[model samples]
Target: MSAPAREVRDVARAALAWASGRRADFALGEDALAADGQVDRSWKPLGELAQVCATVTRHTPPGDPLHARAADLLAFAWRQTGEGELFLRLQRLEPFATYPLEVYAALAAAGFRHPAYEAATATVARTRGWRLTEQEPTRRLGVLHAEERGGIHRDEPREPALRRTWLGGLPEPWTFERSAGYALTHVVFHLTDWGRAAGGVPGDLTDYLAHWLPPWIDTCLDARMWDLACELLAVAASVPGLPGDTVPDDAWARVAAAQDASGALPEEGDAGDPAAYFAHHYHSTLMAAFAAALTAGQGVPV
Candidate 1:
């Protein structure tokens, strides 16, 4: 296997093992269940697990046991909760939030094709109508809205409007700033579905990513922001026809180097204490595995 592909495979294997081992940290337990038989609003870990597993399943090889295991975990979580009803209750409880929409998107991405999931998704979509216009000040919300629409609905309407919003250019004075980098990467991910829908990305937008991504990756790595750097790698992996070298060969290597032997990557280089393992590591490790799977899946050479 090529170096990049091999790196992806190794990282993915380690991440899956790590995530599986840490499932108890995120999985719904009896104590988390509501006495009233409603989905507990405090059980945020379920959503996190759902998204993580969904990413794993999406990028990992088909027929891999991890895929099935992740699916089963998602199903178990959903069932343990109130399923569609829980989502509805959650939506009513927390309107104007993007997380419920994100959960539906993750389940859909993972190929969970239940009617209840579909219904819950449609409810959320209708409730949170497309917030993709430039007027939406929180760029992340716009990106999240786009992700739900494109990832779940597969309906890329308002093409001209979307082009106007994203293709106009990234937020001005872009730097290695962490939040800015994350917002930029998420906009690209929503546009490209983390490389699964590259044809949907506009030429100008793709060019914009191509121009800024390399430097952004370098800056984030230099800063030891492993999670954000992995997200930038994911953006590079998404742009179609961008040369492999655009994503530095050591991009994945740098992220892998930061990972603990148990496969968790701290949010930053200095936060690797085992006592705070799950709190510090899940997001970055998940993103690293996600980047690896996404880049490798594209058959892109490093």
Candidate 2:
């Protein structure tokens, strides 16, 4: 590698290492760290270490609520502030949920941009949990409304009108748990896109290839069993009966490069399919080649 390329890679490595160390410390639980440090067990450590980890993870953007919370929670966890362990624990209960958002915030601070921001927003719509309205043909209730208080209903065989309201009560805790995994994956996808752009465009694909692409491909797989979803979505959009081709060739190229000929993706033509030679195959192949031409090692082309 050239001096500049080596330098960039080294810097990225250092940042990742620092971030990973902070994450590990937080995972160990701040109190445990302090107790081990022998600071006196008479008082709770109040998780000062945890807060520092959070701040480092997010890079502490100015005026962010999370930033403020991290600070307060750190103080409380360490017993430096009035807040207690109960409150601090409650506040940071969903670091996974916060993680994705923090990644985006970090990217912004580092000057990364993404063309898929809108596409990502569409994916989040699935998380909103809406009732399926519209008449049902049989006994299945056609309309699904948020549970009503003491709502009286007759079990009917035919389609019913649909309605939806807010899900009430303390809210199912698992709802957040289930959603966090999916949400984090989505967030990671966006970051991967940004990384790909950064690494490929300006002349540095190494970071993306070594650090980002593997999990990035996994993210796509998490979204769908096969690359077919994106391909299908594209085909649907491209044809009259479908959504109509909205995503540009550049976007398609990124997706294609993530795949391989064997369908396992991440490598060159590993799978063979004569049918793919047509629209699906050609699209992926063409876009990937174009991406390759832009300048390997740099990142996404402008």
Leading candidate by TM-score: 1
In terms of lDDT, model 1 sits at 0.64
Off by over 4 Å in 2: 1-58, 80-302
Q: lDDT tens digits, residues 1-302, model 2? A: 65433332332223223323333322324453232433222121122233122322243244643335434434333343222232223224422122222222322222333324323422432343422323222111211110110021333322122111111112233343323333322222222231232221111222222233333334444553233323222221212211112233333434443454332232123345644433233323222222222222232221
TM-score of each model, paired residue for residue: 0.78, 0.18
**What lDDT is reached at residue 132 by model 1?**
38
| Candidate 1 TM-score versus the reference | 0.78
Residues 1-302 of candidate 1 have per-residue lDDT tens digits of 67766677777668767877777676655544244432333355566566656665665566976567666667765664566455455555654455555655555565654465445545555543534333433355344553564234544454544544433445454544766676667666666654566686678666776777787788888889988988888777777866656777687787777877988888888655768767777777777777776776677442
Strongest candidate by lDDT:
1
**Residue 143 in model 1: shift from native, Å?**
7.0
In model 1, pairs of residues that clash are none
Clashes of each: 0, 30
- Model 1 ranges with Cα > 4 A deviation: 28-45, 65-69, 76-82, 113-168, 171-176, 272-275, 300-302
